[model samples]
Target: MKVIVTDEISEKGLELLQKDPRIEMDVRLGLSKPELYEAIGAYDAIITRSGTQVDAELLSHATNLKMVARAGVGIDNVDVAAASEKGIIVVNAPFGNTNSAAEHTMAILLSLCRNVPGANSSLKSGEWQRAPFTGYELKHKTLGVIGLGKVGGRVARRARSFEMDVVVYDPYISEKRATDFGTRLVDLDELVQIADVITVHTPLNDETRDLITAEHFAKMKDGVLIVNCARGGIINEEAMLNALNSGKVVGAAFDVWSEEPPQGDVIRQLIEHPRMIVTPHLGANTFEAQTNVAVDVSKEILNLLDGRPVENAVNIPRFDPDLMAQMGPFMELARVLGDFISQLAPENPGKVSFQYNGKLAAYDCMPITVAGLAALLDRCTDQEVNMVNANLVADRRGLVVEQGRSTESEFFSNLITL
Candidate 1:
């Protein structure tokens, strides 16, 4: 099997692939679109970050490609639907940079609170202005966390250690989880109104796109500090600017932007703003995170090649030859049943129930349930719905899923009713 690393991957992951006698690896960076199009057909697997776009056009040419691994969380750069239709597996390292991103968020938040950027520049310029560079303590301040997943959970723990009161608003996470993390669970409105510092750690989706808009800004406390280590556009740039100008937001730190390598008037203005601290999307830029993601995604690619179950596949089923053979036509029937049930469900289903009958009960029905859930929720959420987080993603949208089995069937030996 041949593998291509088109983007800069950690040397450690490359070494792993090199040591495998069954696989041949190539590092082909800085390839133009036409060059990638021409060469992709020869490789069986490809690994990339955000630079290379694996679209329908590219996948169409990649006749021999069996898998594409993204060494990071987002797959916005890949044409997932096309890859699925082509029977190509797509994998990503969703947990590789959890610590790195959480730490970066804390770093930026601290910098904003203490005016570190301003102080550093002033000292470098040979000015000793301690009064103007006065810092604020995090103790007793309310910290609002937008998303309470991996990174957000870490941030909440760290903030609590600093004696800061943490309030979280993640519809997906249970109130018990938030309480366990030493955070008070609150609604978006409450968080916005009371928090002294607000941090975002959610994916970019339709519901979250420009989530913190002008109206939201208007509701926030004056002099509230804002941090975004998640995707761009979660906080509306225009609204932030207006808030900054109007003295509603005292300081803001942004690592991601709505646009990469931001250009034109808005970006220029934001970067030049004295109260705003911006980095060029450095949330997952640490050496440790990069290497971890490389190794993680490489392992997933190898798993796919070896016909083993892939853990972080961004699609349903994961295309297991042995499992598919055993399941036979029942798999197809289950999927169709799931589809039928999902269509009859409400616009935002609160729960999904899957009942298995007869011989289907003998086989493990977890994969079937996941496939059904993915098919159902994919129609709702903007983010890619896959087996990895289908149930969790459903829970995020206030949906619950239950699966049951029985040894009774009417027509087929095994039956799946959703």
Candidate 2:
């Protein structure tokens, strides 16, 4: 097996791939488009960060490519559907940057509270300033976290250590789960009104776009400090600027922007605001994060080569020829059942049970189970969910998957239920 590294990864990661005698690895960074197009045809697998674009055009040239692994969480650079159609597996390291991102969120929040950027700029110009940089203490303050996923959960724990009260507004998580993390569960309206400092850690989508707008700012406590280390557009940029100008919000910190390396007049205005502290999306830039992601992606690549069940595959199923032929019509039916059930059920379903009856019970139903799960989950996440990683995705979401087979069905010869 041959693997190509299209981006710079930790040496430790390369060593792991080299350890396998059956694998041959190549490090080829900064390849021109034509060169990459040609080079990818010979390799069985490729690993990249965010630099390469694995689009349909490029995938067309990758005749021998079996898999593509991303060293980080996001797969925006990869055309997942195109890869999936070609039977190529796409995987990412979702856990690699959890700690680094959480720490960066804390760093941004602290910097905003103490006016660290302003203080540093003043001192560099040979001015002594002390009282102007007065900062708020974290103790006894209310910290509202929007999402309690990996990064947000870590931030919540850190806030508790600082003696700050933590409140969370995640519709997906239960109140008991929030309490387990030393945080209180509250609604969005309540969180916005009661929180002294607000941090957002949710994914950007149709629902979360402009999540915090002018009206939300109006509901916030006076002099509220806000931090967004998640995605951009979650906190409406125009609203944030207006709030900063009106003194409704004392200060705000942002790692991700509505537009990365934002160039528009509104983004420029926010950048020029003294009270707004920003970074060039540096939430996952730590050295540890890079190493962790590299090691993770490398292990996944090795798993693919070894025929092991990969955990983070972001594309469709790869079934044996005979299995695919036998499971054709059932796969379509299973997909419909998944889609229908998912829409009718709650947003974040914790458990999904599947029942197969009659002739279906006698044959291997694993493929059908996976197909249903993939269809159900494809709508919920940014990542592509497929039969290859359906159960893994369910497990990661803390969902219990139960399936049963029965020889009895009143109406149909084979009945599948969810």
Highest lDDT against the true fold, candidate: 2
Residue pairs with clashing backbones, model 1: none
Global lDDT of each candidate? 0.86, 0.87
Candidate 2 Cα misplacement greater than 4 A, ranges: 32-34, 316-368, 371-418
lDDT of 2 by residue, 110-169 (tens): 998888988999999999989999999999999999999999999999999999999999
For candidate 2, give the lDDT.
0.87
- Model 1 gets an lDDT of 0.86
Residue lDDT tens for model 1, 1-418? 9999999888975676788899899999999999999999999999999889999999999989888999998777888878876667888898999999999999999998889999999999999989998878999999999999989999999999999999999999898999999999999999999999999989887789998999889999998999999998899998888888899999899998887878857867887899999898889999999989998987887787686567788765544556666764665566566667767777887778889999769777878787778777776767666555576677668887898998888887876777
